[model samples]
Target: MSITPRAAEPVDIDKYGPYGRPPSKPPAEARKQTRPGPAFPNRIGTSEYPAEPGRYHLYAGHPCPFSQRVMIVRALKGLEEVLSVSILDPMRDSRGWALREGEGHGLDEVNGFAFLSEAYRASGFEGHYSTPVFWDRTANRIASNDFQHLDTDVATAFDAWATREIDLYPENLRGEIDELNEFLYEKVHNGPYKCGFAPTQEFYDTEVRSLFAALDELDARLADRRYLFGDRITLSDIRLWVTLVRFDAVYVTHFKANLRRIADYPNLWPYARDLYQIDAFRDTTNFDHIKRHYFGTHTWINPSRIVPVGPDLDWEAPHGRETK
Candidate 1:
């Protein structure tokens, strides 16, 4: 059930760059523009993209929280064998996320691609080329980059081939999961970016306050339950944990989301550590890549491009969350 490949279209790099705004445009006008990710939104297990082992590959970067969500699900669902992944170098330039040969980053094993943009061109897509890209090796195109539901697809689609029996998106919990996903997406997952890229003081003030308020609310919510949905780790936990893991490391200083550190949160801090103790979450996280990408790459935000040295997070310190 393969679809026709599209012709490559011209890309407007500036629109998809760090801030999603062209240089000539005033920062205030950024809100008016929409630089949603590339439009190859097909899902796995569909008629076009069937659920088959070794047919899909993931193109991801450890630094990106969105990409991390997909990687975490892939690991938790035991799709490492069914779906292969390539880790792009964290540092992105004008050309976009690349696969530099000798730099220890993953080579484009599936398509012999140099830059991720090539995948978009090969898929006949045009726009911001972001990860985690779900490549359809069988069709020689990107199966999906719809970050919103990509993790859910990976969580459910390849169940027959999954090495474990984990179900991150259980049928009865999907309604609750969807509601939490929307709330977290608006206030937590994408909050730091809104605050960091805000054009006006008033805008930053509003966004930053809302961001912290949401964090405070989440802290209170987790005070009793072991997870967002109780005993088991669901997609909601993955969504929130990715943000929490990077909050103190990058978001606090880099994004000016410095009202309080996640370390200071009584419940959320330990909960993040609890997830980190799990191999899937711990293995996919790359602190070096995360720090360097935020401080070194976003030169527009930090002109000096100086990567910071000391937040001294003790991720391995005993969380003692097992009883909860």
Candidate 2:
């Protein structure tokens, strides 16, 4: 029993944006304090980016819930021919995370590199050109953008080319799944970007009342669990189902996070439609690149970008939660 260290909470480097909120800007090169290549060998087949089966690639951004939590742990550890992904072009501006050729995105076909800041300057990673970006393609560059440990390193570093080995960071629940994945990344996955990039109005009413008091205490602790550490599915339910599948399609009206809706959470809108009826969280959800990447890339919070259609969400209705 040895644990005592707590007193450091005062970071306000202009209150968010270096890879945090409001269309994350401020890093066009020259910020690197290390990140050039080869650091992320977090075990498995070991050393210098080992775990091979097509030697790593992921870039990801179906509207970035931290690249949909490592693309739902690389599609729940099937590891899609052992860790390969692309899917960028979710409408980011300030010239970042591009690739081109739409329809679930294209280009950057393993470092053809149209953008993504040229795969972070082709290895010499300057800084916040963030995405899922794990890329090593035979040591040509980045091993990780550290999407908070790339969903536990693609759910435990390619477990011998995981064709659905499905552990999702277990080992006796890894200290309560790293304390509910840091309280679901600080009160429910970056708590709607700290109430849509709050820098005023009493800090957006104290972060939208601590983000609906941590989503009303996880909708009463999932009103008797079916997931979030219960019957299966872990990594804290894929980091709270990629922010409840983009909280009413892009944080209820482009990150205004309109007070109440994850369909008004009666147990988190049927636990986010019972993890969107599974297929690795409904085929790694797109929602038109999560509603044109937060209403057309946060033009200082929607300057006539207009990508809304209606609430109109269904997520294929019935989420009975398998008789929880």
Candidate 3:
């Protein structure tokens, strides 16, 4: 059956005007003319895109954990000068994530594009817009939005140009790292979303249990090691850190993954603090963006949209992990 494209609806100008709401959807004519492009190769040495400094740009938002993961890797690998970044406003509407003018949240300086979706459309993607978008400036197209692969590619693809000598994905530990990362991704990393968005009580109950069980296992694992894989941090640590850092503040209440607050976990709490003390992890985290995006935008979960004001955090306090 052929489906006709519906005309765009009139957006509420007062509530979602130029500054407040996302920019209006692009015209139908423009969308139809969007030329499809090839997906960026998994690695950078392909004929399409090469590993060159100052040639790639990352489009990310602070509130998104997926985006946070990529940003954390970028900072850790010292790719600031090698690759550029543009941050979108924390709040998003139906029009999708916006880079408003003069909001001081950083502009879409790469393509001067208004909405993140526009960048996706330009790259021939017609699906839901997502963050941690890897754009190739030289190719004038998006490289990848598959954040799982995107994170590792950003870490390994530019190793020659990376300013830091940290080996996040070491050759010897690849087997262990991949195994643990897959486990964390299913149970802990995406567990809160499953609980929050579940349409049935039975589903929620099942997921919440799985979530806490994974947390308990992680707490036990961290009891001995400072980092996930012994002393040095790895991709697994970065994957888990993004979810843990946001747990007490947003996931506990908003997502109702409230089996217990992350702060209540003995090992997990201190471990989170230890990661936060790192300049890369701490600098990339924006509490304001994290809180507002979850509490304000998820109107289905928070109808009143009244952002909570408690749960004071002390990430700066001594983690005491050095003694362990």
Badly placed stretches (over 4 Å) of model 2 are: 1-48, 51-63, 68-94, 97-116, 120-130, 135-140, 143-154, 158-233, 248-251, 254-260, 269-293, 296-324
Error of 2 at 111 (Å): 17
Please give, for residues 144-241, the per-residue lDDT of candidate 3 as tens digits.
77766677777788899899888989999999999999998878877887777665677678889989999999999999989998999999999999
For model 2, residues 1-324, the per-residue Cα lDDT tens digits are: 332322122222233322234433323221211122333333334576667788777878888787888887877778788777877777655556667776887766555766677677877656568777777777777777766776786787678768777887879989999988887877777767766766566666776787788889888888898877788888888888888888887786776878898887877888888788889888888788888777766667776768988778787889787887
Q: Give the Å shift of residue 5 in candidate 1.
A: 23
TM-score of 3: 0.87
**Candidate 2 structure, TM-score to reference:** 0.33
Candidates ranked, most accurate by lDDT first? 1, 3, 2
Candidate 3 accuracy as lDDT? 0.79
Residue pairs whose backbone atoms clash in candidate 3: none
Q: Give stretches of model 3 more than 4 Å off.
A: 1-41, 45-47, 101-104
lDDT for 202 in candidate 1 is: 81
Candidates in order have lDDT scores of: 0.83, 0.72, 0.79
Candidate 1: list runs displaced more than 4 Å: 1-35, 102-104
lDDT winner: 1
- Candidate 2, which ten residues in sequence have the lowest lDDT sum? 27-36
In order of TM-score, best first, we have 1, 3, 2
For each candidate in turn, give its C-alpha RMSD to the true structure in angstroms. 4.9, 16.9, 8.7
RMSD of 2: 16.9
